[model samples]
Target: MSYVDFSSDAFIAAFFLYCFAFLFYVVTIAGKKWSNRDPIKHEQRWSRISFVTSTLGLIAHLTFFFTRWIGSGQIPTSNMYEFITFLGMAIMIAFTIVYAIYRKPLLGMFALPLVVLVVAYASVFPQEVQPLIPALSSIWLKVHVTTAALGEAFFAVGFAAGLMYLLRVVDFKQTSKEAKRDQFWVEFSLYTIVLVIGFIAIVFIFRGAGYQATFTQENVTIDSKGVDHSSTDTAEYTLPPIVKPYNSTADHMDSFLGMDKPLFEAPSWMKGVNAGRKLNTVIWSVIAGSILYGLIRLLFRKRIGAVIHPLMGDIDPDDLDEISYRAIAIGFPVFTLGALIFAMIWANIAWGRFWGWDPKEVWALISWLYYSAYLHFRLSRGWQGKRSSWLAVIGFVVILFTLVGVNLVIAGLHSYAGV
Candidate 1:
């Protein structure tokens, strides 16, 4: 097989290995209570096995990265698919480093699934390697994207550990108003994660089924000469359309679940030709996520947090909090250097400006300032445990919005990265 094909195979192998490692980590925790098992020996043996499996997966992932670079003759971070897969790989690297230091099996249980989810999400984007545009043809692309992703990977680990801290410490059985509010937000956070999974799952489901719809959208523009220009663009959808593009007509739509056409037109305020499609996707994701969450709730007959809380009873909340803090602390300076400093340097070379106030740049600043505040609150204000954990968790969300939401929802210089 060709190197690119081999790289694809390696990626598949890595994905399965990560999944197996997650299963083994789950066994390490759950099997401790099994009859006829020595809990200590069982935990030790299974944790070791899981860690080895995860390490092998990371190796396979690295093989994919290098081989793809060889085949493509370029670093793979120029596009959404490549960058996200690289992010997943970076997360694994970060997880492996933290796991070695802490030797905590529970970390694998959370971190591996996150790696799996992220890699899976990356798979939804197109994977063919494309040549970088002139704006992206720079050594700084490698430095900025790779370093920024590595830093984000550490934040991802921090988020996982912080989430674990919450699960371990949150009072699931409490009935008071304050406790109930905490319970709601924790459950909501878990639910939001499920939404992401649901989004990925639904996307692949329709894509595999070869579902498609087409729309013709018209655009009108006013030039400096006071002349109106009109143009047409095609909008396509793999999922059934719940909403159609603004000022557009369906070229063709395959009937889905007895619905032959969109139920509504996109809001006029949504300007892009693809805005309707993106909005439709968001709606579908919510639907799929709600259904998935409902099934899980039904299966357990308890809030998801309550179910996970029992598994975390033996874990140390203090250790989880420390791990979360340390991971973010290590990541903060690296993020500052990559997402801001190197980015500005690259920006100057590409656009002749170091600071453009583009949506992406603005959000990147927001993420930096947020993390700066996180560190300040952590070190100066003496926030620890729940407060620090919450900051870590929320900080990752801000990073994600900076990475994804800005690309999808806002048009700017970074729109090239959007799917």
Candidate 2:
């Protein structure tokens, strides 16, 4: 097999190892409640083993990344597959740094699964190494995208800590109505993760079973030079579309919806990269994930957070809250330099405009603004603990949306985003 093929295989192996390591982290946490031995020592033992295994996995994953780099004679940040995998690696690296300082097993328990999920999500995308377009051929492709992903990964850890803080401290049984309302938001965040996981799970099950469908769309646009382009004049396109938009009622043989053909068309301004198949996959995934989550809720006779919170082994909610803030504090400036500053530099070089209000750019700005507000609230208004924690959580959500959502659902200058 070619080196690229070997590297890809190695990548899959690393993903598997990360799954095992994540399970080990969970074992450490759960052992606290179930094991008869000194839970502290037991947790430490498993945590150590988990760290070593994850390190090995990181090594393997790195080897794959570098091998792909060598084989291609270019840095591997030019497509969705490369970018997402690298993003996972970045998150793992950031997690390692934090764990070294805090030695928090709960952190790993929360964070590692996200790393696994991200790697799994990356698998759904096409993995073939393709030649870069002129726009992506610059060295900035490596500098800008890699740095931004790394910053975003650190922000992901903030999300983890924020989540752990909520699970550790938030109490819904309070008699106050406000506390109950706050409780709903906390649970909603967990559901969001579940929804994404469900999306990923359904996609794999369907793909594994060789279930596929297609629809067609015709797009017309005026280029910068004022030249008109039309994909199809007729309502029906002869060639099959890879994905029909979510709002589409095209009335074709839609896979999950199983409709005859959609009767609707996407708006003229709602131009996309034909990433509707992904959207459809996500819809199926939500249905699948919801069923699984429902079954989980039924089996445990409690909410998902309630089930997992016990695995925390009574960690300090305050510490988790602080770590969440620290992560954002460190990550925000880095994110500004990479996602905003470097990205603008690259955009100016490629698109001839520093800021085009692209979806990706706009989301990055939103993340910055949200976190800025978070910092102000925390430091200025004395918002700490739950209030600040929620802001941290929301800030990272914006970051994730900017990282994944804009890249996939809202195609713009950065669509597919290796460029």
Candidate 3:
């Protein structure tokens, strides 16, 4: 097999290993109350097993990265698929670091799933290796993308810990106005996560079934000589189109559940790279996520938060809060180095400017500022516990928008990475 093929196998192995690790971690927590086993010994044994499995998974992921790098003759972070996979691996590394510091096996229960979800989401994009464009062919590409992803990975761990703290501390049975508000938001956060999973699920389902739709759209570009040029490009869809591209018609669409045509054309103002398809994806995610959430609610017969909060009975909320804080604190400076400083240096080298108001750049700045305020509130303003956890949680949402949302919704210098 070629090195790329071997890397593909390694990637699959890593994904399965992560899934097994997540299950073992779940057993470490959920099987503690079993009839035949000592709870403390059971947790210790299973936690060790889970940690080993996750570490092996990380090793396999590393093998995939290096092998792919060797095969492609370029670092794999130039595109969405490779970058998200790398992000998943970085999250595992961050998780290992925090797990070592805290020796908390339960953290694996939260962290491994995030890794699995991220890796799975990476599969939603095309996975072929493509030649790097002139803009990305720099040594700084390695430094900037890897460091930034590593920093974001730490924030992801902080998010997991902060979320765990919330589940541990929040009163599930309270009915007062403030308590209700808290409950609603916690559930909403979970629902949002479910939406991402739903999106990945729907995409793979259609892709595996060989579903496809194609459209031809006209493009207009201005030349360096200030001339208008027109061209036609093909747009393809894996999911049935609810909304077609603006100023375009379908070349062909496979009938899905008897829906063979697009229901609407995207608005002219919504122009962006794959704007209509992205909007369709968002719509499908909400639809699938709501259905999945409803099913889970039916199975549990309670709010998802209430279902999870009980499992957190033995965990200390204060430790979780501190873990969240320290992880973010460690990540903040690294993010500044990667996302801002190294990024600016690379931008100057490539674009002959230190900064441009690209959507990705703006959002990166927003993420930096957001986390800066997070640290300020945590340290200078004396925010701790729930308030601090909330910041960590929301900070990750901002980071996600910077990483994924900006690429999906806006066309800019970074648009090539979206491919």
lDDT of each: 0.94, 0.78, 0.93
TM-score of each: 0.99, 0.88, 0.97
lDDT of 2: 0.78
In candidate 2, stretches whose alpha carbon ends up further than 4 angstroms from where it belongs are 218-230, 233-279
Give the lDDT ranking, best first: 1, 3, 2
lDDT of 2 by residue, 274-371 (tens): 54544445556667778888988899898777776665547888789888888888777887888888989999998898999988889988888887
Each candidate: RMSD to true structure?
0.8, 3.9, 1.7
In every candidate, how many clashes are there? 0, 15, 0
Candidate 3 lDDT (Cα, 0 to 1) = 0.93
After superposing candidate 1, which stretches have Cα over 4 Å from the reference?
none
Model 3 misplaced stretches (Cα beyond 4 Å) = 219-229
Q: Candidate 1 local accuracy as lDDT?
A: 0.94
- Give the per-residue lDDT digits (tens) of candidate 3, residues 83-113: 9999999999999999999999889999999
The alpha-carbon deviation from the true structure for residue 358 of candidate 1, after best TM-score superposition, in angstroms, is 1.3
Better of 2 and 3 by lDDT: 3
TM-score, cand. 1 vs. native: 0.99
